[model samples]
Target: MSTPTRKPLDRHALWSLLSEKSDFWTEVNVVGVTGSTNADLAEAARHGAEEGRVLIAEEQSSGRGRLDRRWTSPARAGLTMSFLLRPTAPRETWGTLSLLTAVALEETLKAVCGLSAKLKWPNDVLLDGRKVCGILAQAEGGAVVMGAGLNVSLTEDELPVPEATSLLLAGATALDREVIAAEFLAHVGAVYQSWNERGPASVIERWQRNSATLGRHVAVSFPNGRSLSGRAVGIDADGRLQVAPDGAGAVETVAAGDVVHLRPRD
Candidate 1:
């Protein structure tokens, strides 16, 4: 057997297909390499970049995840991109941006790649309990920039961590970045438009249906140095995770944290 060749995304094709799929996206920008798509989009948002502008990079030198942790992948090994949004929905609903994005990713992987993806609360998409995608949302002025990195063609030896997996590793034969990216954004536009028009209840419902974290024992470490171990009960209206702590503590609502699913004791 030989290594499969990874193809570069077709900028024109993605722009055309995404436009036909949804009128929500304004433009698509594909770069060979970038420091960070999220950083690029956030700066654009500050300078009045209109909503629906997308920035995608074939490789990221300074990619980042939540808590500013470094994220990196070989050139063309994955789909790394950022999308800009300035929704007219109530400001309170904005927190659902990452959740909605994760939901869209789950839908896209299933629809386009025939893979059943599950959402891990906050901003992760898991396959076989391994992370295949990570999402990060940054607020810039009145706009929001959401970035997602989906491992596509990385092999076992190329994985960043033992806990990470990719589409190829998950048995996906079709690894077209353009199709995956387009399908994902199309889903994003649909969910986002629905959230703005029909409110976030529907989006939240979809997220809950695809979630793997809810109802599971989890340990969350907050930025403030506090931690909670509990069963994830629900997602609050503000997009925080509501957890029923072990023992006898009030259900804790997590705004931001690193979550690790804990196995139940035998």
Candidate 2:
């Protein structure tokens, strides 16, 4: 297999770009390697780090996804970033932050790289029905930390799972990490502000507009082996997933679960 050509991002260049383009970012830190950007930011938040602090890692040795699944990628072959925020909104609204980032990333890819990406409700970004990105958000007290891992240049063999894809494999026109990161942060900042002012309605509207999960049959699984099969209808006001249980029932609001889109029966 050929080696990846993308090198570690220069913090100076990234900070300069953020300073000129982003409205909310206060600090940007890039590490060559880390266990998880989310972990780093969570620790910083605990230590009183203010909002708009970002941590990006070239590689994550102990990266994790939703439900504590492992997330790994080759050095400099993916975009791994976490942002710390202190929001004025109620804690319940924090669930929408991951949705906000997914929408922001979709817009960034479309406007920056010309790649068509869609959100697979709750947290995954899909390209041609295969995951290209994953988002995880953790909230504590007034601070909320979000981590996003995007597959950029990973080859087929390097993909951690069969249902995963990278921007390169998805035929993105550009592969500039700086440009991608800058636009994503800028858009996320805008979305965060809008979400704070207008609440999840506007954010949910955009997320639904670009979603591939709604209006489909899905199975929401729990670690305890319990599952619910339903037709995903929408996301509620509190940012919980709304699904109409399989047969004929009321819309059930799911606080947390692993969602899987089921194939249409023949």
In order, the Cα lDDT scores of the candidates are 0.91, 0.90
What are the models' TM-scores? 0.97, 0.96
CA deviation > 4 Å runs, candidate 1: none
Top-TM-score candidate index:
1
- The reply for model 2, stretches above 4 Å from the true place, is 1-4
Candidate 2 lDDT, 57-82, residue by residue in tens:
99999999999899999999989999
- Write one digit per residue (lDDT tens) for candidate 1, span 1-266: 23569778899999888887888888999999999999999989989999999999999999999999899898999999999999889888888989999999888888888899999989999999999999999998899999999999898888899999999999885788988888999999989988989888877888999899999999999999998899999998878899999999899888889999999981
| Candidate 1 positional error at 8, Å | 1.7
Q: What's the lDDT of the predicted structure labeled candidate 1? A: 0.91
TM-score of 1: 0.97
